[model samples]
Target: MSPEQRLASLLAMHGENELVEFKEAKNQYAFDKLGKYFSALSNEANLCGQSRAWLVLGVKDDRTVVGTQFRTKTADLMSLKKEIADKVTHRLTFIAIHEVAHPQGRVLLFEIPAAPQGLPIAWDGHYFGRDGESLGALNIEEIERIRLQNRADDWSAVTLPEASLEDLDPEAIEQARKSFARKNPRLIAELEAWDTPTFLNKAKLTINGKITRTAILLLGLPEAAHWLNPSSATISWILKDRDGLERDYQHFSCPLLLSVDEVFHKIRNLKYRYLVEGTLFPEEVEQYDPYIIREALNNAIAHQDYTLGGKISLVEFEDDRLCFSNEGGFIPGSIESVIHADAPETRYRNRFLADAMVNLNMIDTIGSGIRKMFQIQRNRFFPLPEYRLNERRVQVTIIGRVLDQAYARKLAACPELSLDDIMLLDRVQKQQPITDQQARHLKKRGLIEGRKPNYYISAELAEQSGDKAEYIRYRAFDDQHYKQMIIECLEKFKTARRSDIDRLLLDKLPDVLDANQKHHKVKNLMQSLKNQGLIENDGRIWRLSNP
Candidate 1:
């Protein structure tokens, strides 16, 4: 219905409902308060299984239209959509702000869309909902109920009405055929007899000879990208210098079947050379395993949320590391589950895209994809893949070279340690914190020791690896050791400055503590000695206790 007809229909209602809110903003409305109502109504719409909610300005809570002069100009009023989008979750805003000239006066009807599936809408980090016409915080149960609506409808499984075989690139289709034949080698001779449309159907890239978004993304010509409209199929490859400056960049649009190779070749996979502790000759290997680059890129393409209209990004930093980022939170939730699970994850952000890629030999959901990435890096003595997952994006960084050449070979020596166990130990070595539960699990294996945020490889593992000295650097010393040293230094030096005390014990502190933390540690230690009447201080200087 037209905006005028819809407004009249809503006006005839007995009172305001969960999907509609009426406001008499005679002169102005608070932007923040407006945002809260937007969040509340949007969330309520999702919960009620409705597509949209309305916020009618110039209309009172009693359904009386008194007219509003809020942003009377058209451009000024429409800009509110962007204003709301900037602060709301996922940048989702109004479908349209409808203006209606009613018999009462001029009314502004603000259209708000429903929250995206599985993700709740929040205004300034707070969720709001309606309690029988009263606005309040969305309760935990309601919030979870909204969040649990995870992608109920699969966008990738949809077929585009305007797309056909003519839109597909010839070269990309040929590559797809080669990949599919290779994946199903038993059908090689039979595949030669199949036609283009017939082959695409068999490969699951189309439905009943109709092109799917997956087909357009993987094999469709560049011009066919328009069929996906608001969602583009683009992969961006960027190269950066050691200083994190972008030196070169390229954006590859459909057909992505061939662009994957182009993007891979653009990455400078130089040879990484490192020497083992006991060896004179430097061991050499390719900076990135070929499978790693392909798997990571394909995984990004397979899991990317195309509805966001963002490009999959692969950044190569001076040939040392490759960081691949896609626009979507991880479907499997955590990298831990993917690494530790014996089976593959059936959940995917783009199920149809991932399945087609598997048929095209671009990706595999089996353990060979993610789990093998870790094992390959482990076998090469490199750090395990790093996953940075959050609400809107998933980024994975692959370190191309060994961090500690000495400990790397030794880490390999821990054959009894599972890949998952070593993965957590790798975090400890990098000074990354593990949960208390994780620490306890590792401690039970005698593979780690010390406290949270300062855990170190255990003494037994250190002895086995013959890196006891390195272990001591990570291990923190007792406070008594530091206190006695300070007392002894004061006795010999008469009056030592704060710097002198720092010099005495700063290097003796745990390597994990940064400069500021080490200074804080010294401050605490000096305060402890003073409280015990073990030392006398003259402001900047300290002397031995005077009884």
Candidate 2:
């Protein structure tokens, strides 16, 4: 069938749905907005399990062909594909753009490929998806559904009969032997007595005495990567400076078991020393914890969706943070569940690979790794590990040092607080919003005080911890302070404009209030003074009543 007829048939059958977007670009359309639509429609197609999405230009919202004059030149239209690929995540672009001249008007049909499984398409680092007919941020629940789709299938479990023990790297195998022996000290002699293949089988890297994709990815020679075909077995370590500029980068391919240590060694984990209030000597600790780094890298390896052909990424910033990302969402839904649950993830994207790592002493599968990361940060009085998960990927960020010494000292002073409470307080210190339920709990415990969108640390606790000035900075000031400031300003200037009053009082107002709130506060104080015959504003300027 002709492309026009096929599109017409699709429109008649499907109308406008999640996978089909009709835009009446009558004269023209912005290129950037077009990119966003591509991201939205492509991700929608993935969620709907469709092969492709259609961006039908010259079509009205009601399915009428309005005829668009968008990018008349053929070359200009064709160049859009490359333009979009340049800015989008992973270089995903349109599959085809068909210009069909209909009887009434010309229709421009752009076919967008469905988002790859376990990897949502993003435009300029922002993910977009359809919410019925409205386009916005992909719903978290829908994101989770797309992420959970691969939980039942294990990419690492697929056996490759063509692959032989010869494909494995000898050095990697030796390293794996020592790691496995260390993990199972009681069977050290027995494990050392076995041959390489026997040891690989025991380590769960082999399937039914045969090498699998997991084995190739973890221990195979770099040249043996062809056995995995389209999928890559590369870990990219990137070092970025404080200004977000790339300082250096190194890619580790195959022999991932040994590459973990190599990547760790490349990072400049310098010693961080901080002086205690009472201690004579400063305490020294490594900026990045060794266990934290290995666990993060191992988690990335275990959860990466190899079918997507994306490489694991480890990004380090000179400002003291490490970010590890893998191309699959967190399996257990939320980080809170992982931090609080007694059990490991119920399902894994790469179960066989995770099992092998667990056996090889790379990571623990009992769910203690993530919680331990949080606890270790807490013990050091540093910010907890952050897990940023969406449909496309999971990124874990480990902060190395204290961001705010006052906040850290406050947390250290309060040892009775639970980890959950500490996490919420950390959010407050970072100025991140929390849910109303969390606010209520914090208020009930005297941990926080004030109204919505303007909460501050409890005044009593702030005073006790020597943070009273910070508390006053964030909390609303008493009415007397506002009145006095205005009276003093008007008295000094003899006549003051509202803007002048704003300049005098705005900064003195609570840090929690936005500009509009501060304006209202000043206006109300002036009105109250006027009512008592102390001050009055004539059109633009205010003056003392007696003056």
Candidate 3:
């Protein structure tokens, strides 16, 4: 059978189960419900070890093909991709939206890819799982099951009995010793007294003096990689120009303890200078935070799925953004939880490796590192790190440089704003959409102006910050200004068409409004004028009431 026939057959064969959901969206369907089902079906598919899940919109619970008139327009139908991506974890969206024309009626098939093995897909910050034929919070047991997938037989903790301490790099071991000493200042003398094998054991890099995969990753010589055969232990740093052409690239192998430093040194930490409004001097800072860079790199190394045989990547862009990615799903369910709670992760992808890194002072076990990255950027008035977690890997982007000078100045002016509030305002500056809850919070504080999806810094904020121009730009003139414009248009032409009135006022309206909304704004202005006896609209034409 053909692909479409195959899909139809599958839908006919299955009822609402963990991997399939049936909805009779004859005329319209709730978009929010679609997002929830996407989350539920994706998680359910992962739990059942399925490659994909089905969401049939035109099908009823009893498996009847009623057809759907939902989002009939191609553009509107396709826009669901972005709408769903905005709120889903890892930006997960439908893999494909298929329309099947059957002998009985039409059918809409939403093909959703399964969630990553270890990461549960969440819609609007809530994980959904299928409970029989209904949807509910992913059961604690299921959540734990997903988390355990990442904890599977940590390759880094596996012992390589034949490998000896001789396979380790002496320089790497010395560096490890210093890091461990710094981490344990009180035990410095004791740490120094131990030999290589003893120190490795004490540092948890070895299993009772027996070489392990973690030992080879952090302290193994380049040639020792053979001991871990098949599992690759390497980090590749690649630089790309504006055109995406490779400008420079280098790979660092085993002995990651020192190679991490080598990778850091290769990056061009240029000085970024931004003008501080109301001051003659410009504030200068590094493109990227040194601590953030190290933390991200070490986190990648500590959490990397070594058994996957994929190399970690550090990709640098000419636009001053650095991306660090490793082969594994994020151990923490979400980055927001880590940032807001600032609590230690309850589990780790590579527990032994993470413990060793913590002992060496490479990463913080308290889970403050990611939060620190956000705080550092907030203090600098730069964008926070962007995290993209997927089934195959966890990627983070550290944006450097001030994206908007006005935004930075506003931050400086408003010292009382919390980091969370600043983050929302930062999204506003970047033209990214904020959640309704966030919009209401910002609106309640009089910190934002205009309708959502186009909210900008409010005039109140601008006035407080001495940004008179921005205040005027974001806050369009009041009813009087629009009223005056309508009167002027009528005066210029004895009678005006509704289209003419729109032409006079639409462009002058707030940029936040769409074309249809702008048209309504013009009609509302005409009605207000008519109510005041200043103008009258005789169906198609508008004119001064007296005229």
Q: What would the TM-scores of all predictions be?
A: 0.70, 0.69, 0.66
Candidate 3: 10-residue stretch with minimal lDDT = 332-341
lDDT of 2 by residue, 1-547 (tens): 5567866876685567788889899999988889999999988998888878888999888888889999876557756767887777656777667878777687888888777666677899888998788889887777777766655657899999888999999999989888888888998989868987788888999977899999998899999999998998999999999999999999999899988889989989999998654467988999988999998998899889888889999999999999999997665556764554434555677879988988888887677888888888888888988888998799999988988776676775677887778888888777788765467668877788888777778886676577777777888878888898888877788998888888888898987787898889888888899999999878997999986
lDDT by candidate, in order shown: 0.84, 0.83, 0.83
Clashing pairs in 2: none
Tell me the tens digit of each residue's lDDT in model 3 across 456-537.
8887788778887766655667889899988987888899898787777777787656678778877788888888999977
In model 1, the Cα lDDT at residue 35 comes to: 97
Q: Which ten residues in a row have the lowest lDDT in candidate 2?
A: 337-346
Candidate 2 lDDT for residue 112:
87
Q: Name the runs in model 3 displaced over 4 angstroms.
A: 1-152, 477-547
For lDDT, candidate 1 versus 2, the one ahead is: 1
Each prediction's total of clashing residue pairs, residues at least 3 apart in sequence or on different chains, is: 1, 0, 0
Model 3 lDDT on a 0 to 1 scale:
0.83
